[model samples]
Target: MVFKKFTNGCVNLVNKYLPDAFLFAIVLTIIVFLAGMGITQQTPMAMVKHWGTGFWSLLSFSMQMVLVLVLGTAMAKAPVFERLLTAIAMSAKTPGRAVVITAVVATVACWLNWGFGLIIGVLIAKEMAKRVKGVDYRLLIATGYAGMIVWHGGISGSIPLQIASGSAESLAQQTAGALTAQVPTSETIFAPFNLIICLLFLIFLPLVAHAMMPTKENTVTVDPRIFEEPPAPPAHKFTPAENFERNRVMWIITLALGYIYIVYNLVTTNFNLGLNIVNMIFLFVGLTLHGNLRRYIDALMASASTAGGIILQFPFYAGIMGMMTGVSAATGTSLAQVISNAFVSIATPVTFPLFTYLSAGIVNLFVPSGGGQWAVQGPIMMPAGVALGVKPAVTAMGIAWGDAWTNMIQPFWALPALGIAGLSARDIMGYCVIVLIMGGIITSAVFLLFGGMGWF
Candidate 1:
């Protein structure tokens, strides 16, 4: 009952107070602009210049992010995956089971690819809600978001993968001691400690979400009609061009060609799974699952509006990142330095990863982009980790987890999921706050114990 009250109160508070994501981005841009003026030696004009120049710095990265969400969402809506989700959702006859299964499936998807997990989670929740009567709509959405909790520690975590890739070596140009060599996934994503924490959350998060479900009288449910998917249009006689567009023969050829490229990539790259490759993998898998050009195109078209919100908001964050990073030498200390040093001051061998995690969480709120955040804090944190005797991989993972940790409350990463759910951040975030707290505790304990044990 105490938890129930807290959840309800939180929901009410957030829904009432929080602004739309666009406004939130605008506020962050203003805050960072002012913060740069105060903390750095740059003149107002210089700061404006920095913001302008940096606004488009993430153009390539921004496209990659957009595709991940757009393509993944497109893939999930394909009939093959839809039927699969519906079949699974049918087994969840009770509201409690529906929420748990949604979390489990989302967690598994997120563990594989954050984009995949985010889209699939929302779609699955909608399907489950349609099949199962009486589930709290808000909690179901929250459960879908909650399953993404494990993404940072999962295979597609940005920081961990950044350090693993050859491209991370370019960071040395920015800071004196940023990592100049690749760090392997074995040390971070696949580490024993990380795996242990992930497994525990898989078992634990569902029970907590299930228990948090509101009572029947207090539950917030919408008419199931809202959850209903519109039926696909029936096929009719077609012209040659239309027939060619819908032809399964061409789709089969496309699928075969896509698989060949994917196979060649895996073989030549020695199974390297970078962001672009991951997106391509999703593309092929999505095409095959979708089974034809016309169906796949329809799914893709449905994803555009859901993706456009995130696309519009990312530039503001890039501007903020630019103003924060492009500091004048005369200021004598960068905000990134001050932020990193705050945690570094108290860090020792046993506690370094914890502080790194905390600092990354703070930086993440302001900087938001995982790659962008790392480019700032990574330089400072990487050397500090080596000095304090935390393995580079552990330190890297610490930052990765920290980046992912605060995302439960950070609205940027939730854009895809929220857009698909037709809800705002407030509808889902109150429950995510609970997850943020639980994940922080579990992750911190694991980091400390493992660092002490020399596990990773």
Candidate 2:
């Protein structure tokens, strides 16, 4: 009861202060601008230039993220996907059970693929909210978002995969020759320490979610009516164009081509599953499962609205990344480098991973994309850790875990889930802040205890 009260208070406080996500991005931009000037040698105009230059940096990444949410939501709207999600959601008999189950499912899903997990988690929460009366819809969604806490330690984690698959020449260049060879998954994602952290999150997060549930009077349930699928348009005799839209022949040919390339790529490239491939798989699978171009188009149109926040907000974050990584003429260091360097300066061989984890979490606030964050911090931290006697894998995973850790409060990654749940960042972030604190403790402790020991 005391814990619930505390959780409620946290939620209330966030609800009071956290603005709309777009506004939050603006606020962060202002903070980064001010901090850049105050800490670095850059003039105000230079800071603005940095922001402007960086604003468009994520255009390619922005599109990919858009599709991650859009396609995932579209796929979820397909009858088969909807039925599967409903069945899973129906397993939760009570409000408390609903939050617990959503948390577990989201965590597991995130472990497999963060993008896949993000959509699945919130979709499941939305489904549960429809069926499970009295469930706190905000808490349910937040529980889903909490699953991201383990993402960097998961199988599809970018940092782990990057180090494990990076070409020796490219990695050597990125890490300043500190990492000339690939760091296998066994040394990072599947490492004992990393596994322990993922397992702990999988175990305790559901309990945390259960404890955070608001009381009956305070619980904010979703209106199931809001989720009702719209009726399809009336059938009509078709012209050639219309027939093409509705026909399975075209879709079959498209799917065949897509699957053929997918198989060829898997066989030839040793199953390299990057973001583009993930999006392609989602696109083809969604198209196949929906059974016709018209139905898939309808589903895509229905889910397209959810991409608004991502479209509106990501560039500002890209600019924030710009400010964070833009080097100051006077100090010769970017804000991100300054932050990373501070942690490195304090680290010994034993504490390197812990410090790296801590620093990455901090940097992630400004640059939320895992790949972007790595581009900024990896070059700096990797070599530093290697010099301190820490294994390259340990250092890399520290950065990975760090990037994933603070995502709880970072609204960037939450956009997709927020869009799916029809909630603002403020609505769920309060609970996520709670998850952030506890998860930080869990990951920090794991890194401190065993991160430097090199399980590989």
Best by TM-score: 2
Off by over 4 Å in 2: 451-456
lDDT by residue for model 2 over 1-456, one digit each (tens)? 888888988999999998999999999999999999998878999999999999998999989999999999888888998899989988989998999999999999999888888888998989999999999989888998889888888988998898888899989888878888988898888888889999999999999998888888998886899899777679777899988898888888989999999888878866766788888889989998899998899889888998999999999999999999999999899999999999999899888888999899999999998999889998999999878888888889889988998899999999988888888999999999889989989988887777455442
The lDDT of each candidate is: 0.81, 0.89
- Backbone clash total for model 1 is 0
**Where does model 1 exceed 4 Å of error?**
167-175, 178-181, 231-235, 451-456
In lDDT terms, how accurate is model 1?
A: 0.81
Summarize candidate 1's per-residue lDDT along 1-456 as a digit string, tens digits.
Answer: 898888777777888888888888888888877777777766788879878988888778778878877787778777778788889999998999999998899889888877667777888888887788899988888888777778888987877776676564474553356567777888888888889989988987898788788788878787878756688679778899988998988898988888899889989976756678888877888888887898788878877777777788888878888887786767666666777888999998999998899898888887777777778887788888888777888888788888888888888888877877788887878788888888899889988888788766
CA displacement after TM-score superposition, residue 68 of candidate 2 (Å): 0.9
Could you tell me every candidate's TM-score relative to the true structure? 0.92, 0.97
Report the number of clashing residue pairs per model: 0, 0
The stretch of ten residues in a row with the least summed lDDT in candidate 2 is 447-456
